[model samples]
Target chain A: MTTISIIGSGNMATAIGTRAAKHGHAIELMSRNTAKASALADQIGHGATVAALGATPAGDIVIVAVPYTSAVDVVTHYGDALAGKILVDISNPFNADASGLATTPDSSAAQEIAAAAPEGTPVVKALNSVFGHVLAHDTPLDVFVAGDDAAAKAQVAAFLESIDLRPLDTGGLGMASVLEWTGILLMGLARNGAGFDIALGAEVR
Target chain B: MTTISIIGSGNMATAIGTRAAKHGHAIELMSRNTAKASALADQIGHGATVAALGATPAGDIVIVAVPYTSAVDVVTHYGDALAGKILVDISNPFNADASGLATTPDSSAAQEIAAAAPEGTPVVKALNSVFGHVLAHDTPLDVFVAGDDAAAKAQVAAFLESIDLRPLDTGGLGMASVLEWTGILLMGLARNGAGFDIALGAEVR
Candidate 1:
């Protein structure tokens, strides 16, 4: 198992941290508020750690589970501490009201985070298509991942498989825009009475 | 069986027309070039007819199966001929390079056609996710339908089901933008080496 450090002690952090911890991966829940981070870590309880904001990430894989707007600030604040680590961005750049995509099609939240992170940091985009609550359920959905770094993508895919989830690779980092759109579409469908039961799956032959 | 009239003598027109013809739906293949349209109808001899460009559409469902650029013109050119008939748009508004979506998030090809057609015209969006070649095969993929008019959406969905394809209803006309984005995502995945054997399907729980 891998050591996974999750930034932002929110619902997404708790959900992902719980899954990773249950899969035998050591987890670190980092937050600006030490109490919130410690609380999430305690809830996760498989020897998960609590880290303060701006500290060096405790895991080999640093998951930035924050809002799209604050993604750049978090990456920049970590600075060189994130250098050479596998940074996973699980944020969707969705505008208010879910009316349309917030980011241009040419780029995505992962790409923006990649630009902000220190050099040599491999940023992969995953866990954004399906709802965080869905993965927390007993049955999880297929996960779509995209990143330019081959090794980084393989590592993330392996982690997904370890938790009994399907990882659908959609090629290089450029595919992140489409991946984020899947989230917007899934959310739009969910709100429009398609229900919250949403997951990306393969076509039946 | 519902009658389906498909405009354009292009790949999509032939592909969709052939499928509809096989499913016992009376079909009309229309084009600006009479010979090309006639040839397609002749190629598909299941009681499919050919209509000239300005001629009145033959079926209750007139599929504007042309490129995204020609959609508005096709709806407006028919004018009163399309009145009271269900107009189904299967166009994907993609940029030249197909790197991103060319349409705004608020509107889609179907909405634009709905606006251009004479009063009482119902425009439903369908069959834009997978390639036409996929449907030309024995097994077809899932078809997503979206429209403001419930009756129009039902007709399109029924036609798709008759062809043994799954039709997913993605809610109101506003979902059309997201529907169009699905095409962009599929194309981006196809070009990025995921291959043309693409079909939109839900995960097998």
Candidate 2:
């Protein structure tokens, strides 16, 4: 069982924390709202704990669950505290209307957070493609991951596998931008005709 | 049977023409290279014919199977001749190394072609997510389509359905940019781990 530290008390944070807890992994919830974080920890139940925001993340795998706008700030706040831990970025930098990506090809949310993170911190982009409700409901889905560090990606993939989700690695951190576009693509598909409950996956022939 | 005119004598033209012909659609191959076009026509075999480049395309639905760089030139060259025909843009504006999209969010190949196209001509972006080789292999796959006109999208969707491929409408022509990004996402997936034989699709829960 792995220990996963998730920052933020948003829908994605709650979903990931609840699922990880259900899967027998230790979960550490961190949020600015201490009451909300404490409540979330209590709700998760399997020895889940709430850590003060910006305190050293207890888990080896730290998931930044805040919005893309705040992801960099949270990581910068954590600073050296996140070094040596695998930082997981699950933020989708969607524009105001959710039509296109707010991040450019040169700067994805993961890349920005990596820039702000302390040296030697491995930032991996994952789970941004999935809807919070679907993830929370225990639906088995494919999670596309991107990171510069192979070991970090492997560890995140293992965690995803433990929770009954398939992990598809799409190469280095450069692909975090592609993955961001993919987040927009998923929204476009869901809003258009595929419906909101749909998940994108690769079908091998 | 809908008459489908394909521009270019390249891999995509051959693949789409061959498949549409097998599905009993009248295939018209148009190319700057008459000899190559004729060879492709002979290869398609089912009432397939070659049309002179820049001349009026005989089919109501015309598929521009050229590269993104040349797509606008081809459309602009056709001008009023393609006024009412439904133009299908399948060009993926990939950079030299195929790492990301060459076109910006404001100008996808479809949008560019649409801007160069004659007034009242409906331009739909489809068959781009699938690789040319995969489309030629008779494997049924989902084809994501985007266009401004509802009737045009419905017609293209019907044609896709007739060919035994699922048609997923991803909204209007503005979504052409999203589809282009999706094209890059697919390439990133293929090059990374999904393999070249994989196809991306929406999995509905």
Candidate 3:
């Protein structure tokens, strides 16, 4: 079983952590607040563990479940602790009001994290397009992933499959912007009456 | 059946013109080169007609099938001719390399066309996500639409339905940026090995 470490104690982190644990993959919830992390670990109802933020992650795959700015901060702070590990960035990089993207056209939270990480660290953008409520429930949501390393992408895809989620590889790390913009498009659709439970999937014909 | 006028004699124009004509919509192909427009109209067959660039668009739903910059030029050049018409802006607004958006974050090509068009011209953003080749052939494709006016959106959706394409309303015209970004994301996916035949659909559980 693969060990997945989530670097936040929020809804996204909990959602991914719970699903991973349920799938028999080890779960580690790491947050700046040890108490909150432990509480979440207990609430997850699995053999989920906790670690203080900035500590070395035990799992081969580490998911940064914080907001765009905070995700960048956590990844940058972890530094070498994340080296040689697959960093799954689930940040949408939305603007403050969630109306649009905070990142530029060429950049995304995943790209920022990838740029901030050490040379050997592989950054993968995933789960940013799927809504959290859908993840909390049982549903087939397509997750599009973009990263520079082929081996890292394969590992991330394997983990997603383990958790009952299908992943679509959308090419190089530059496509992170596309993945992030899709979140904005999904939000716009929701606001236009599609609701927040919707999932945006990239499919082949 | 709704009469659809497509501006520009490029691939996008031909694709929309052919589909609209085959679906029994009155097709008018408008271009700077009247001969080219006539050739496209003839190829489109199904009684598709041709018009000069600045001539009054015969159809109520006028689709600006040109690129982002040229779309704005066409809308502005038409001036009062487009007033009271349903203008469908299908520009992707991609930068030179197609890696990013050429427009500013706050604005989009559709919004730009909406602003440039005379008052009372209801602008609808449609068909920006679906590729041209996909539109050329008979295939199911999801067309996300955004417009401030409900009546205009309804007409565009009806036109899309007539052509056997699904129409997804994604809120106000401001969401045009999201629609355009989805195109960039799709291109990024194609670059990432997903190829150009893929389709992105927004769904809910």
Question: Which model scores highest in lDDT?
Answer: 2
Clash pairs, candidate 2, are: none
Stretches of model 2 off by over 4 angstroms after superposition: none
Candidate of highest TM-score: 2
Q: What is the TM-score of chain A in candidate 1?
A: 0.96
Per-residue lDDT, model 3, residue A176, is: 85
lDDT of 2 by residue, A125-193 (tens): 999999998899897888898999999899999999999899988889988988888888888888887
TM-score of each: 0.91, 0.97, 0.93
Error of 1 at B85 (Å): 1.8
Model 3 regions more than 4 Å off: A104-106
**lDDT (tens digit, per residue) of candidate 1 on A1-205:** 7899899988788889898899899998878878989888889999999877888987888999988988899889999989879999999888897656688756888999999999878989889887877778747566778899999888888988888887777777887877887887777657654667766665534
lDDT tens digits by residue: candidate 3, B1-205: 7678889999999889988888898898889978889999889998888888888888998989888877888788999888788999999989898978899878999888988999878999999998998888778787789999999999888889989998988888888888998888888777766788888887776
The per-residue C-alpha lDDT of model 3 at residue A182 equals 83
B1-205 in candidate 1: lDDT tens per residue? 7778888998899888888888898988878878989989999888788877867877888889889898888778888988878988889998887766677656677788888999878888888887888878859576777788998888888888888887777777887877787887777556544677767665423
Q: Which ten contiguous residues of candidate 2 chain B have the minimum total lDDT?
A: B98-107
